[model samples]
Target: MTSTGMTGTDTTSTGTTGEPGDRTGAHTDTDVAVVGAGPTGLLLAGDLASAGLRVTLVERRPHATGNLTRAFGVHARTLELLDARGLADELVGTGTTLTRLRLFSSLVLDLSRLRSRFPYLLVTPQYEVERLLERRARAAGVEFRRGTALRALRQDAEGVTAELAPPGDGGAVTRLRARYLVGADGVRSTVRDQLGLPFPGRSVVRSLVLADVRLADPPEDVLAANGTGDAFAFVAPFGDGWYRVMGWDRRHQVPDDVPADLDEIRGIARRALGSDFGMRDARWISRFHSDERQVPAYRVGRVLLAGDAAHVHSPAGGQGMNTGLQDAANLSWKLAAVLRGDTDDPQALLDSYHAERHPVGTAVVRGSGTIIRLAMARTPLRRAARTAVARLVTTVRPVSAAVTGMLSGIAVSYPAGRGAHRLAGRRVPDLLLAEGRLYELLRAGSFVLVAPRDTHPAAPEIAAAPGGVVRAVWANPSRRGALLVRPDGYIAWARG
Candidate 1:
């Protein structure tokens, strides 16, 4: 969700924002300055602050965000990320989970087969996730300045300086400097514009209406979805009585500004799903468009981008918000390491943020685009063929497993260097430790050296070599080798 277009100013020449800090000639006022307090920035800021870095989060919106609902599905991988932060179970309790997702009326994708503890998609409002993250951030000492917008940002070898416009019109401009900056400010990011990054892609669908309503007769399935040649519709419970309904009509391809009504949504649902399930009494309704755009690079000098600021996708597989949260998971630890002087080459480590995440962003953009295009296939013959092919492919166990893995993001991985361990760059499954589980240990937000109980006596020292890396002994000593798992639950290094 973009802000009502930023002030479109880039006054970086003189740091005269009428603040005393601006006249101090200091290299940096804080460790990190994060724009946008959404899921991405909140997670990043919380992680950085937890790692002892001073972080400031800026949000253009007021503290009271009314009915802020968007992005309903949280995939398995994203849930695992939250688990590492000790928030997964609490968040899971606030939403409903569906083990299977139906597409095009037939061809169900089974999420129950996923290996993750969270093997299903969680159906929750975007605000629920944000609320939890914002609470964690506040507890971790993240300075949040609501009703503040980033007017401009200038980066140099030393640090980045940001020009901020405060709450009201004619409010005095403020200057903030930090060692690094991040743009998690959604699609229309002012930080991105100041960096001159091009978000190159086009809109995938127009006039898609979203609403939270009550179903007079709820569908037996946890989720209901189908796409007729002329329209597409999906409905899922919010765990509350309210169900989120998304529908699009081919005949009514109006602009996003056009007000959406229950009548229009009911017509589209009936056409696409054969029935509206007696939908009634809408709680919220809005019209919008979906796009598949991504920035060329996620990093530029001292500034980096995450979340919708770096990439955005069609709401086809519900990957938009999950991907952004994962981006924060990938970048936060690396940034903490660099800022804490845990790395020899900070630039190389920072560059790896783009290297690892940009490819994932690209894949999500393409995958979501393909799913949306196929859902909107015009001809009857094409739709039948797609359904047939989908059924056939899904019947094959490996193909179905692969499909679910990618869609749920459990199969996502970074590149390993030459001669690296096979486990390196791969996701580390939740292993049983002597005292607890792998994810529980990750709540410390540090590297974890998981060693077999029979490993060398020096294993503890080796784990300690990485500063705060925690040493975990396997409950099953029969397992071989020692694995170094990153804070994000990915294997970093392993030895037989």
Candidate 2:
């Protein structure tokens, strides 16, 4: 039976609510439907809905929890992106500022070298970031459907058809049809599975122990690290005297079999931080080995993957969340353009997302792998060598800046194709505008081109692109200018 109901309830065979009727007959229609309400999905949904697109976000989980501490730091670039969306100040206010990231081994490297308004990392739990994003998404009029799972997806000439099931009962199936679908699901994404995408990568021989615990005596320092030998430990202070501790298991020689017990945690802390440390209550604990992997492509037909679904790498550099957020920002603008009939070449623009992001992901995987190996080298010779290199780099100002740039994600640049200027593929540094700050100006919407230098003769033509906003100003000379900044805060084009 062909039913034209908007309530998401339609009868099918077997008397189930959402069961597909005949493969040919079932399809629900909307502008965009996003699978998973994680940070990426929520942020994308919010951006799309805020831009006046109809969006529906589905999550498999029945309720949100505060237990997991999956990701801990939001880098400077991420803060700038959120600030562009008017979200950074609120989030930064809640999380503690990581003034310095000190690397300790045979030698020490202080990360205060990176210059930014947000010079240090912001330490906030993954759940808290998600909570804030979810609130913002709701405020932006995103339709959030909790306790829903996407069972199957099929795309055709017009749009995509997704079969969704309610959580526990598995009672009814709803057919949601959308012009496009995004899979913001995590590493083990069902959408990826359905699309038959290849997630190729390698897993390191060693794994690390990660836990969020209430220490009897938390470290006074914002972050402490001991990386002298095969055994290494890093402790960072979260709010409320709780600490997130990560360390290598010296005795076991691997991350597997590391118990989630307080006793084991205390023992690790004793080795990494000194014997006097006391660990009282364990909040959450897990074992994770580094995996460097990326999907060969970001899109298959109308379904697209973002966040962990597209790339999963070592947590050593804290790039996971920041990368995911940027992915959403990049995709959101393109998706909005296509939905609004402003772009004729949707696939070309869609391909640009992967083209721009894949290389960045590759670099992150390689850089983070190097850092992890250096931190976990067992042999005395290799450890000594790693220590010497770290110390040398720290002493050199340019080298330190480079390392800080890598960690802060400010150094990433995307391709601007042929005939693009030097600023192509670079992040536009926050600049001073005649009216206000550059970041403040971007808070309104996506795609801002700043003509700070007044050098580009084509500034008028470039700014006049359909559906784009360009701001022209005189060069400060103290700062960089004439940048094509994406909604995600990365420089798409720049001038020397």
Q: Pick the candidate with the highest TM-score.
A: 1
User: Which residue ranges in model 2 land beyond 4 Å of their true spot?
Assistant: 1-28, 104-109, 167-169, 205-207, 228-230, 253-259, 452-466, 470-472, 475-481, 493-496
TM-score of 2: 0.87
Among these predictions, the greatest lDDT belongs to 1
Query: What tens-digit string does per-residue lDDT give for candidate 1 at 1-496?
Result: 1100011112132222222112234567789999998889999999999988899999999773455577888999999999999999999998999999886666689999999999999999888898899889999999988989898888765678999997557678999989888999999999889988789999989999999999998888789888777899999999988899999998999998989899999999999888898888898899999988999878777788999999999898899889999999988887887777665445556666777788899999998887787788889888878787688757989988888898999999877765666766788778879969999999888778888775653433243333366888988868877877788888776777
* Displacement of the residue 57 alpha carbon in candidate 2, Å: 0.9
Off by over 4 Å in 1: 1-27, 167-169, 457-467
Predicted structure 1: lDDT:
0.82
TM-score of 1: 0.92
Candidate 2 local lDDT, 126-231, one digit each (tens): 7878888888888988887888998888876567788999866656998988878899988988888888888899886365778887766667666877654546
